[model samples]
Target: MSIAINLLPPEYRPRRHQLSRRVIIALVAGGLVLLAYVAFLGEMALAARRVAWLEGQLALYAPGAQQAAASNTALGDWRQKERELEQLVQNGRRWGQMLKTINEALPADAWLTGLEEDEGKGELTLTGGSTSLGGIGDFLTNLQGTNLWSMVSLQEVKGNGQSLTFTLRAVFPGAPGDAGKAGTIERAVEGK
Candidate 1:
């Protein structure tokens, strides 16, 4: 045993602490870990909310989007039909109108024995009988004056004054190898 002596006064003495340095460091580290875990959870919640909102918006517009796609398909079908109709209108010839034109050009005394049409050659052969040669000439003149034929030529003339028979070869306006041009029915009728 040795004798002990106090060097500092009571007011200036250091107080004893319940926690050690290692324990305080461990407590601070645990608090920081807890704070990081809470932050991670908050971030996850925000992301989930955003995803739900986006899904709701997509659902709201889905019907309209589907309808618009259907409309686009229908529009394409309509355009195809319209093109087909236009092709039909352009390719089909008006025979009734052509025959009416021929009737209108025929003279009162002249009668047609045969009206032959060569579709491949696009030619018209008018075989008819007239009271006089002058009547046949008048008929040819009337046909030439119209816009129906690009070329009109007298093929043959038989018989005398009365009961004269004549054959006239006339080229359709849009026939190949002629100076005339092909056009719509309305344009041909208008002589344009």
Candidate 2:
């Protein structure tokens, strides 16, 4: 069997060399837009990631800041407690010395029933009873003669002829004022 091939004139035939210009332009534009959109999204995602990383770092340190603040509060409270305890100890020592001084100053026959120290007011209250009035008078004389006391006032005196009770108030270390400057205690208490 013979196969017949048809040959058209060159002018009427389709030209393979000429391409669809608008279609190619549209395809290139579409590809460029898609690429640009992808690039824009990538940039946005990268910025979001950076922000998240910064937030995470801050979150990790937040607990440390809270702990430091709590520690500071605790330290401040402990310091206050320590100061209070120190004040108590100092007041106790001062009272002990006052008692010792009072005991040494008292006569053998006279006895002290109460020796009270008021730390807030910084005063000592002496309440005692003696068997003889002469002994009480002598005690007062001796106390007055000493330079260690300032404002040594005999606040009250009661007697039953044979015995006497006395209430006296004095500042320990010494009397206040310009003489608030404390000198020697042993010398004053041992005066003739």
Best by TM-score: 2
Clashes (backbone N, CA, C under 3 Å), per candidate, total 0, 0
Quality of model 2 by C-alpha lDDT: 0.70
Q: Which regions of candidate 1 deviate over 4 angstroms? A: 1-89, 180-192
Task: Return the TM-score for candidate 2, rounded to 2 decimals.
Answer: 0.52
In candidate 1, what are the lDDT values of residues 1-192, reduced to their tens digit? 998776799778777768988999999999999999999999999999999999999999999999999999999999999999998688545778978988998989898999888867778899999988778887877887888778776777888755989888777766774564332322433331
lDDT of 2 by residue, 1-192 (tens): 999765988898777876589989999999999999999999999999999999999899999999999999999999999999998886444545656666777887787777676655555668898887666656666665665555455566787887778876666553233264234323343341
Per-candidate Cα RMSD to the true structure, in Å, reads 10.9, 9.1
Give the worst 10-residue stretch by lDDT in candidate 1: 183-192
**Local distance difference test scores for all models:** 0.81, 0.70
Predicted model with the maximum lDDT? 1
